[model samples]
Target: MENDSVEGLKKYTANNLLDFLTKQIDKDLMAALVKELGGTVETKTNSESF
Candidate 1:
């Protein structure tokens, strides 16, 4: 699945959309949201990889 546009992730499956959201948001902030949701997030490199 490819999120080519700003709203592309909205067209993704639930889990994929969540993953895409996490990718779009700031890692630290998104990780906090994850913790609040009873989920864990990895602190990874912030790179826009192709």
Candidate 2:
């Protein structure tokens, strides 16, 4: 099952992978609520990070 998921992810380009991961992080942050940690989360794009 894990291998299948990995194989599926392999189809994505580097930019797509970064975008997907960023969105996922944003979702997690929203769910967790950064205010609880006394901080805010900034979701950046692939180009913005570099």
Best by lDDT: 1
lDDT for each candidate structure: 0.44, 0.39
Q: Any runs in candidate 2 off by more than 4 Å, and if so which?
A: 1-32, 46-50
List the lowest-lDDT window of 10 residues for candidate 2. Answer: 10-19
The segments of candidate 1 whose C-alpha lies over 4 angstroms from its true place after superposition are: 1-18, 22-25, 45-50
lDDT for model 1 = 0.44
Task: Give the per-residue lDDT of model 1 (tens digit) for 1-50.
Answer: 23435554433332232476634455555555445444444545654321
Q: What is candidate 2's lDDT per residue for 1-50, written digit by digit as tens? A: 22436654433332233334445755554523333323333444542321
Highest TM-score scorer:
1
Residue 38 lDDT (model 2): 32
